[model samples]
Target chain A: MADGLDIDHIARLARLRLTPEERALYEGQLTQVLGHFRQLAEADLSKTSAPFRITVSDVSLRQDIPGETLGSEAVLRNAPASRDGQISVPRVVDDEA
Target chain B: MSESLHTLSATELSRRLATGSVTSRALVESLLARAKTHTVLGAFNSLDADDVLRQADAADRRRAEGKSLGPLDGIPVGIKDNIAVREQPLTCSSKMLAGFISPYDSTVAEKLKAAGAILYGRLNMDEFAMGSSTETSATGPARNPWDKDRTPGGSSGGSAASVASGLVPLALGSDTGGSIRQPASHCGLVGLKPTYGMVSRYGLVAFASSLDQIGPFARNVDDCELLFQALAAPDARDMTCFTAAERKPVHLPQNRKPRLGVPRALLEGVDAGVRAAFDAALEFYRAAGCELIDVALPTAGLAVPTYYVVATAEASSNLGRYDGVRYGHRAQGALNPVDMMERSRSEGFGAEVKRRILLGTFVLSAGYADAYYGKALLARTRIRDEYLKALQQVDALVTPTVPSTAFRLGEKAADPLKMYLEDLFTIPANLAGLPALSFPVGMANNLPVGIHLVGAPQAESVLFALARQFEGSHALANRIAP
Candidate 1:
């Protein structure tokens, strides 16, 4: 009772890798959950809220003036893997590079 | 002291403070003591006994100086842990942010503080406000104070339970789908989910940002209105806050006219006992000269599907910021950065949360976005139009809030389908972004049942006026169970 999407696809979408047993278990659970959503399909969904985004202003330029510097160590402390006082880790897809 | 403390409604407490029969300090002391006694209910997240006492002392000082702040001055209110209160660890009952302290207060929290209302502690809720039962909480499911074995309905479960058990007079809760009304119906209290943007979302921890709305919980309808007036405003911080909605004045209606819409389609799934109680309430309203007519909202049937798709999609994106990078619990010994993101997220979020995120990611993926998210948006439009059409016919729609009253805690938790069906009656209001109130009509099987009274957006004054008149005519919902 699986859809076109299998366990591996579902896990990949979630950024999770699962064991064989877990894959089997989750596949069944996913099917059941989808079945439950059918009841919602019965609803008449006509009123949609506007797209949700953080209410922040968009001006990328920073003022080129003497501004108070933030403690670099405090900022880097939250980074998972920083090296030489800079954030360092996996390289995202950089087609040009 | 414990029994008396648990029963003081916001209205009664306000009256006592005004008459000098009691000071705010005494009321806060009794509340603080009773909260400790009812710890088994899982009604609170983080509370500083000292801080609450200090706030109460200030309220008394203000009263003595003849500086009454507002109608809710000196009355206590609990912050749903999801709503930020600076200096408190605003854990939304999740391991993700176990000890993360909010740097600033939410607009609602700021409003309550400014109004001279007593700051009660944070109450428990569903993790990310995703589940129908608060059982998904990392802290544990909030207990029904009436029957400890049963769950107090969720997301706002603790807020509802705390008031029902007399631990507090009123508390704040956020409803996306049935988060507020479901729990209120389950626990037999007054819960209101104002129209979208009715209350500001400035500092409420994001959970389906588009659908998430902060609302109030109380023992009666008037108390709910009192908390609503205090918390709602056109905050400059929240862009969604309405500029037109007013903090409804305490309106003692000079006119006897009130109209209620009774939608039979919505009432089809209501339990026999609940329907019996609801029917009795309608008769009472009719006898009192309030108009009750059957109205139609054909598209309301699709609300749950639309809500799940829209809410989950927003939740997946909103929660993406938590990558063990900034706030919340992080993996102690990750071999690499990618490993930390995976382990920290998997360990921090609950099963239900992870499940929703996975579903959301799939729906928003390259191939399925148009079918899932796009179609859900269309359905939402239909639901909104149906509500607008029906509102032209009557003032408000009346129905049973849930299929039945509060059931045993684990009875539906194990079956996800059973749990979601509990929201069937309450999701439409959220989908349409309309104001809906759940008031304790009477009781069924000794458990309280709530009748949903829905109104057009910014039409709270109409709702409040009708509720007061309904209270004046009905059985008084006089049973005080603790």
Candidate 2:
């Protein structure tokens, strides 16, 4: 079991930008947390199979018919930036130079 | 007369409403006044008195027309902020969604409206329902009404405190791992986390999808069950919710005394006061003709560790949608989209949320998945099997809801692992997808002690029956925090 975590790498992967202070704080705390979680390695699961999802028997599925949904105006009401009834975001690609 | 209306049980309130002894408007006004008086308890994140009174007046009109909706008509109920209610700010007590208002009502909210229940306050919770105490909330920690210095065990601390303090007769809370029950235990109330698929989760902001179940907090089991019946209907919007046909098969046998299971090994390190109360509770059950059987749950110790892995993993995925564009807070001065997303998340989420996201990302990362996440999943299966096996030998398993009563605020705040251990007994039920209920048995150290009961899958009726039997004999059933 790894005793320490790469907080910077993990934060990057999680899409969170941590300050040096947060990184230091989380590095210590998460290491201790993972140290406790590492006990899972001691569990004897020789006979058990890890299913990705827990089976819930008799779950009823609705028909494939399209139904009412929130209108664009209502949906975009909470958006940080919007234009012409659409959520506006930072540019994803650079313009061709 | 209005002052005491907040203290009456939902059943009693319903009778008063039926007989015109009290108007829905009167009850809402009473609760609003009480909630304002106890603002120090920090039970509410948002309470729109005008809207609530309007809803109440509508219910009163319906009653006046002799068109009452049912037992819940004209009754006020607090809602945990995570569950969406149309036009209400659903913050989840976090800065991430600070000003966001829900455009649509969650299934639970819709059901409460359909039942003619007046949706009251936006109850506070741990940010994203992440912590055992409400300390993680961006607004502030909700103080236990029992003792303001202490926590009212959480993620649903506000829900428990609101009801326990008589600000509201009923509140809805979601439990991923003991959120509702632990708070209920600390505040001396009845809380239930129904079978995993029993309640629809259409609009409950997901914490951990598999383990998350919305339940009720009330002063007694009857009130809890009444609210549960209102919210437990299956919804096609939530595919994991079980159909009515699927839920019909499990019924508690009325002819025989329930055989209560005691996991002696798991009870080893509990506090002496809590142990004494639990022992007394067991004796009461035994004297009441319940067959007490010593059952083993050997794999239960790993439940906490297993839960962190699974819950964090799920939370990390579910919370990814708050990317600063569609909804929630967005940070300024970012050169690119990726930078903006990262900066927004860093500025938006609280410390505990960031920690979990990092831990989840780490465990699910390449090379580490097999060692941590994969192993935890295997352990989860073992834990589930152990619970199922134990249930086969007993009608229900009984344990202390928490190791001890509510702790002083900031006692476990600095220690994350210590806080996680608060859910030790409660996590197994969530992991196994079984129904569990927590009800106050007695007091320890001038604080309430709760006893927990775990039942078989889809056997909420069995758990409720057992809780009612105990509550009928226990004096602490209708207690309100001073």
Let me know the DockQ for model 2: 0.76
lDDT of 1: 0.77
Candidate 2 clashing pairs, residues 3+ apart or interchain: none
TM-score of each: 0.89, 0.98
Q: Indicate the worst ten consecutive residues by lDDT in candidate 2 chain B.
A: B244-253
| Runs off by more than 4 Å, candidate 2 | A50-52, A56-59
Report lDDT (Cα) of residue B52, candidate 1. 85
Candidate 2 lDDT tens digits, B1-482: 88788779999999999999999999998888888799999999999999999999999999999999999999889999999999999998888999999999999999999999999889999999999999999999999999999999899999999999999999999999999999999999999999998999999999889899999999999999999999988788898898877776366677887899999999988999999999999999999999999999888988999999999988888888878878999999788888889889989999999888888888888878888888888888888988999998888999999999999999999999999999999999999999999999999999999999999988888888888888888688767887
Candidate that would win on lDDT: 2
On a 0 to 1 TM-score scale, where does candidate 2 land against the true structure? 0.98
Which candidate wins on TM-score?
A: 2
